[model samples]
Target chain A: MLTRFENRPHALDVIGVSVAFGEVCVIDNVSFHVDVGSTLAIVGRNGSGKTVLLKALIGAVRASGTIRWAPETRIGYVPQKLDIQRDLPLTGRDFLNAKADVARAPATDAQRVAGLVNLSQSIVDQPIGTLSGGQFQRLLLAFALVGTPSVLLFDEPTAGVDEPEEKSVYALIHQLQQNEGLSVLVISHDMTQVQASADHILFLSHHGSYFGKTADMLNSERLQELHGPTVAHLRE
Target chain B: MTYATGPGAFLIPLGMAAAAGLMGSIAVMRRMALASDALSHIALPGIAIALLVHVNPFLGGLIALVLGTVLVWAIEYRSRIPTDVVVGVIFSAALAMGSLLASGDELIEALFGAPNTSDSFNLIGLGAASLVIVFIVRYRSQLVIRLVSPDLARPAGINVPRLDLLYLLAFALTIALGLRYLGVLLMGSLIIIPAATAMRLGTNLRTMQTISVAIAMLATLSGMLLAPVLCLAAGPLVIVIAASIFFLSLAVRRA
Candidate 1:
């Protein structure tokens, strides 16, 4: 008998994936998966393939490995949008209402974005260029949620954001996974955030360190070796 | 048609206004302003060269513009001092060469006085410019403003390089044909000031585009009307006015 899932079956299976940029081998033959309705926290130091791996999965980066996903997989991508001078003429309502202009109707995009970011109605009509840093990050997050995809990939979603905002964002992510059974993939250096939000963990070091359930993989010796020197300074 | 006093005299200001408003917006944005400026400069005799052969100056200018775009792309894609500096040097050199090629007294009619725009030529110039603006808006509209990401400009997306090339063709055609009124030496200023002013006043790309066009139109019209009455070159007159507006905007932004 075929097993019944509450939501559609969406799984990300990566087998022996290796990536190279010029002379450096970044993601060295890594492999892992995140079951539907669960969270995968990718943790590592600066320059780990965490970001590179995410880019590869998004098809922005060329990869030597295979990433096979279920046919119904919806990818909600949150890419970096902070250039010195951004030419996008988006407004808060454009983000909240999700419309670029009256000439271009954005109702469906707006509703989906509104669902994910949890933006208050206070700033809907505000010009996007004038938004605060935190607001901008949230806007990118909302951008990711626009398609209501099965798999949500976020790169440093809460880097410059404050603690409260970070918690709420994580909480919302948790709620989405619990309610909709969405597969969440988040990259972060924050241990507390990982513990709060992830069920499984992928330690992305230069060397492939650990990949398994979050609790079991943390105590592994390879991980301990990698995390040993930095653990004291990471408390903050 | 009467040589000095005729119905076609209206084109002097109208053409100047269009060129100034359109190019000014591009210049102030600084995205592809240098390229636009370079093409406009090179298009001096670019049109005259075409006119000399009894072909369309607009098409001739377009050929030059295409060549210039290709050159810039080649240099930047291969070796670079950054595209902006490359564009500036190219603009200066091309304009100098074009001016030298187009220096005779008959060239004065195409450049300074614009007595050449009589009957069908006026119609052609006006119609062609309007079409180019429409084309840029429909096809190269993003070049007028900003985009989300450079990658967003990739294939099956809003490709910046392609948009730039297409926009430059239209720009070359307009500037080459627009030579009937605005002249060459003073063309670059018009493309920069109004857009710069608009940028200071607006936050989004769309707002910047709209405000820049509006400002350019105002500057172009007023300058065109004042130049002949004041016995000044229409192109330079418009640039000065646009520059004044730009400073005013900068002062306002600072305040």
Candidate 2:
């Protein structure tokens, strides 16, 4: 049945979402919903449409889907990577205020957001081109914090950062989730992250998928059949 | 700058430099400097067509560039094709058509410009100056946001496609303003060099923009002054000087 998820009360309610590039269908019919103050992790292999799904959710790319956000539920996003030109003279403070009025946006707003992401005030004045990988990730997190978004979406947030930094970043995100009641949707290949932070899981393949509570989704017989023995080890 | 010609000669390049310096910074930040360069060359055939039909060359170049800009915009946003390749194809065709249509002194004048002629004085100089001032004063931040990432700009309620079209139109207009002085081939150099030099020297967007305009003004003024002594055209001399400034900034950056 065709479903309309618009103007609903859920933090994010997606129904019959599908994306196609030319003749190839990247993401087939998929549907799911997340409540406020919860974390959802989307898991898929390379080319299984994980990134596309996240982009579609944020309306970055067009897709045939019914995506509804609860009224006034502002969104913030941290991309998997941003290829900022090395020569641009953009400072971290400039990045944070890219979408805000520098004059009207209080200075303390940046400080407060920076505090949430554990970023120092001094670092915000430094050029973004000079930042270390981990520092850059923290700045990206601060970027999402600027507008006080109720829903935050992160796409492979630690893809290029050091592996150890992954846990720390997710921990920061988890902290934000609890403290602000922010609905979190993250796409990650790290099973540890999936096990650690996700309240629900959406596992997608090109033609088929699974979506449910994290515990139930991990123990599914179909998931085991699809991913072989790896699924069993992922269960926590 | 001591000009052997009338004071009006200095006005055109001065205005052109201001527009190029500011707009070039946007092009550089968006990583579209090469695309801007290619688009300048695509104006050649239109100038030739205008010369053939006895119409204003600026009108012809503007029409061609607007069409080219639209084509580049369509190809870039419509599909996954890389922008440089699409613009490159159009540029090459325009260059060939221009070569076929013009020759001898006409070709030399079209490529290097003949700004000493009386017709060089136009309201475009005033229009370009106003555009530079207004753009810097108001739209700089929004333009920066759009260039940074359309994804971010969209959530901010910025109409990404419309803003992109507006920027491209402004780029075309800026380039057109310089066609009498810098010509089709060399106008893009004025647009790219000053901004690139300023980028090496700055730590923030405002500083970069300020430095870009300053460098552009210095280069244009100095080049105009030296043109008579060097027996060279002001446009090309300005480019050489701007390049020297860029390398000097690189040295400063390394230091």
Candidate 3:
């Protein structure tokens, strides 16, 4: 199903991307491309520079590389856990409205996206800090859904959510992807979900990096070489 | 150092307090409560310099605050240092330099404001207050988004760094506006206390801002009215009232 977009135009192309902090190199000379309306799952160990690469792609960090996006690319990014204070007075509605206002989307877009994410008015009206992990994840997804972005970048979308909720979140993402035909780049630890949902995989490690069709790369001997013996456990 | 009588006296401080409240709400949300207080101390050395050179102290303080805000912004961006750490370091140096330059009485007045309200000062204060209020109202959404996360803001087409600089500038300006009435030592209290109280009580963003501004204005008014009766300085009295309100808010459970 996902291979249909392979013949279409490229949504993003990254060439020779490298990121360094002081003397330590984080992402080293990585290159990959994603076709329009396709899902690319980025997998890595804890310190493998997965988040850094995403930040570099979104221009949030300085990197020496060529990151070219198709013309008129509107990106919606859902970051990992934020360090927001528990007593913060901002409600979920405030967060959504703020995104809508900044993106120049209509004022009603907040309501529209809330419906898409299955967030009730009461849930969106509560202070963001008071939200449960699952509710907050939904809120973040709803925030990303505003302005009808063409590209969605998610960094550990289910980091704080429970096990059951994780599957639902992925389902919601898949539904949105199908409906909107969005190009998605997701950083996830769930290998099973990545295998089931993603069309392509970009695995980063200190040892080496690999990017190719998900099935081809998953079945290749290079996966074992790059990921070490832990590859067997990862598929569980 | 004499207090002004009549409407200009009442109106200017009220406006300044309102601006302080609004700015403080953001400051507290940004986790700059203590840092913001420290930031006010940066104005002290400027006031001392103004006293020595016979220039308008407010002007000197304003210049210093703007420069200090820029310095904070530059250091924060360049080194990726936490803002509180940077402000704390700068503040200590500023306080030391300020105390060394000014004598006992001059230092006391600058630290704990002796309002010598002039027509020019009133006009400038009002205008600055207006600017702060307008900016907060207009760009509140962007500020809220940026506060949540800069990554979120960048994708939404908001210029995060520029907005940060602008916010720092506005914070500095609000501090400067209150310097004449609250002084460097006490001005930060006027800003932080009311907002702290509001944070305890507010259910949402709009309520938070509204409660903060109202509390700030009320404290200013009560301080102005009760100062002459209590035979005390209005600046300190204003902070006292604001602090009292904050303490009072502690009793009410957040909904």
* Backbone clash numbers for all candidates listed: 6, 0, 0
lDDT of each: 0.63, 0.80, 0.90
Query: What value does the lDDT take at residue A91 in candidate 2?
Result: 84
Cand. 3 TM to true fold? 0.97
Q: Stretches of candidate 3 above 4 Å error?
A: A228-236
CAPRI accuracy category, model 3: high
lDDT-best of 1 and 3: 3
DockQ for candidate 3, C-alpha atoms: 0.87
Q: Which pairs, if any, clash in model 1?
A: A87-B146, A93-A124, B23-B191, B24-B191, B24-B192, B153-B158
- Per-residue CA lDDT of model 1 for B1-255, tens digit only, reads 113344466554465455556555555554655555555666555656776787765566657766876777677656745667777878787767666666576466445535334445566667766776676456533442234443322211244566655655666566655555555555555666676677677765467667777777777677666766887766666678888888887766421
Using TM-score as the measure, which candidate wins?
A: 3
Chain B of candidate 3 versus the native chain B: what TM-score? 0.97
Stretches of model 2 off by over 4 angstroms after superposition: A1-8, A102-108, A228-230, B1-9
DockQ of predictions, in order shown: 0.22, 0.43, 0.87
